[model samples]
Target: MQIIKLNNGVEMPQLGFGVYQIPLDETEEAVYQAIKTGYRLLDTASVYGNEKETGEGIRRAIKEKLVTREELFITSKLFILQTPEEKATETIQYSLDVMGLEYLDLYLIHQPYGDIYGAWRALVKAQKNGKVRAIGISNFKSAKMIEFVGLNDVKPQINQIEINPWYQRMEDQQLHEKYDVQVEAWAPFAEGRHELFENPILSEIGLKYEKTIGQVVLRWLMQRGIVALAKSVRPERMAENINIFDFELSKEDIEKIAELDMKKSAFFDHDAPEQVEWFMQRMLETEK
Candidate 1:
């Protein structure tokens, strides 16, 4: 597994397993399968409602002597509803307690809205206290990201956002480079939307490499120095997602895939007010 060195000197795996929509009951099994498939990075969130089970899977792997904690990279997020400055530490600590872990490899503010500054302050404190190795934000636009960097004492180490062929966010990538922040793609496959499976360009490229369209897309993102989180509940898909290290995309293939970019998300837009309200409602529902 290749590693992306953060500005803070922390090394993160370029590819990781994400459990965004994974059911709580099945998270443990799925996470275990991912670990068994040689995936060392596990991306979960407090909002995912499966941190406990996710940690259990990690513990099970460790107990069986399959892998050590040092070999694993665990990442979780601070839910938007937990944005009150006063609640930040307690919330983060609760995440650590629930996971039964001493420290997190990375912790992120899950959204751009709410008391993000306060939440980031808490993450900064967590880092200083050794509870989190690195801190960052997700779904932040370039303007907001710049604002956060300018205001905060500790700049964000990463910015996780939706990045796939349809929603490349190239401008944000330049901003990330300017700030020395690593970019992590959350919906690296665009959740299989945008008729991604039937795209002729991707199919043609996949045929040449003898890889799936999904694998080609992921490899494209990885080749561009972006960290990709590929989620899969099926065991075979999990193995397929990580088997991308062997093949390299040719320069012509990369250009063809780049031309496929439509520059829009298949899902909700983060900048829209309705989307903000939706995010708030979901966070509130989870808190209740």
Candidate 2:
């Protein structure tokens, strides 16, 4: 229910639902359940191969009057394309059609690879024409964000990156602040990487608040002003994730959780060459 204003003055929810690895057949129901559980922000991507189902979920919710289209914040991303510069518009249209929406609340460059400038320009154009509400990028680190923001006419409103107890990017947080770019955290639980859920630090904090470690982590991010994207298929978990607004993490608790910072992703590096090659291969596979 809390809103963070982007650089362009667009408002985004503090906590959101993501559909990264959710199976296609089940995505609609998961999304529908999330909406019913009071999640207004839904994050998906073209590469996730479930936009149609995600859209169907939104449609079912709207039809049942669980929530209206305007009440929800929808987001999807542009994937690595052989020639994104040329195919960007078409790809954006494909997401819109499959998602059964005229415009997206936020559209991001899934990765900083392949014709990014061209894709970003296309997104900027989409924003001007009302195809998307706001535009940004994902997996973009500080250095890339600095150069990208300096060169582009429109600055990125949100830079979603890896942020969790084990791999907290505190230094990157400072850089985003300098540019007035809001940071949205993906994998806030680190996908349970680095044994995040079992950590004594987070566990101790949770015990004091009578909350789960997941709730503690989400509350940490919310206090830091980072929009946290948490994915869950269960209705109870969805409700718990958004129920973080009631309690506040004290300064001492935050500092204790901060000690658990390992300062790097448990997953592979996003800007590394091999990672780039891996995503490029994915692009080929998807296109094929």
Candidate 3:
């Protein structure tokens, strides 16, 4: 596994397994299988409603002796409702307790809404107290990222945003690099939008390397120096995703794949007003 050291000197796996929308009932087995198949990085979230099950899988892997706790990197998120200093602290403790872990390898504010500054302050405190190894924000675009770095005493060690062939935020990535913030790519495949798996360019590159399009996409992200999170319920696919460590993409191949960029998000726009309002409403509902 490739390891990237964060600004705080915490080393993380370049490729990871994400449990975003996995069903609660299946999360345990899926997580366990992922571990068995050689995945060391695990990503889950408070809103995913599967932290307990995800923890079960991790513990099971340990009990079975497939991998030790020290070898794995586990990550979870602070939900929108938990984005205040008070609630954020409580939420961190809750995630630790529920996930059955001593400390999280990384903890992130799941979204950029709510009391982000307050929540970030809480994360900073958690890092100081040793409850979290690294702290970051997810879905934060360039404008918000700039603001956070300028205002906060401790800048985020990472900024996990959407990155894929279609929505390649290269400019924002450069900004992050300038601030010494590592970039993590979530939804790296664009969630199959525009038939990413079938793209001629990617497929051509894969054919050249005797790999799958999925493999090519992940390799591209790795080449761009972005840590990528990929989720899968099947063990075979889990193995395939991590199989990217071997081959390298040629310079010409990288350029051809770069031409497929649409420079937009495959999902919703995080900067839109309605998107912000909707998240606020969801937070209120969750609070109640």
TM per candidate comes to 0.97, 0.97, 0.97
Q: Write the per-residue lDDT of candidate 1 for residues 77-102, one digit (tens) a residue.
A: 98877877778888889889998899
Clashes of 3: 0
lDDT of 3: 0.91
Which pairs clash in the backbone of model 2?
A: none
**Minimal lDDT window, size 10, model 2:** 80-89
Error of 2 at 219 (Å): 0.3
Global local distance difference test of model 1: 0.90
User: Which pairs of residues clash in candidate 3, taking residues 3 or more apart in a chain or in different chains?
Assistant: none
Model 2 C-alpha lDDT per residue in residues 1-288, reported as the tens digit of each score = 899999999998999999999998899999999999989999999889999999999999999999988999999998877226568888888899999999999999988777899999888988999999999998898999999999998999999898988887888999999999899999999999878889888888888889999999999999999999999888888988898988999999988987888776789898678987887787778866
Q: In every candidate, how many clashes are there?
A: 0, 0, 0
Considering only N, C-alpha and C atoms within 3 Å, which residue pairs clash in candidate 1?
A: none
The list of candidate 2 runs beyond 4 A from truth reads: none
**Candidate 3 C-alpha lDDT tens digits along 163-259:** 9999888898999999999999999888889999888889888998899999999999999999999988988889999999889999999889879
Task: Estimate the TM-score for candidate 3.
Answer: 0.97
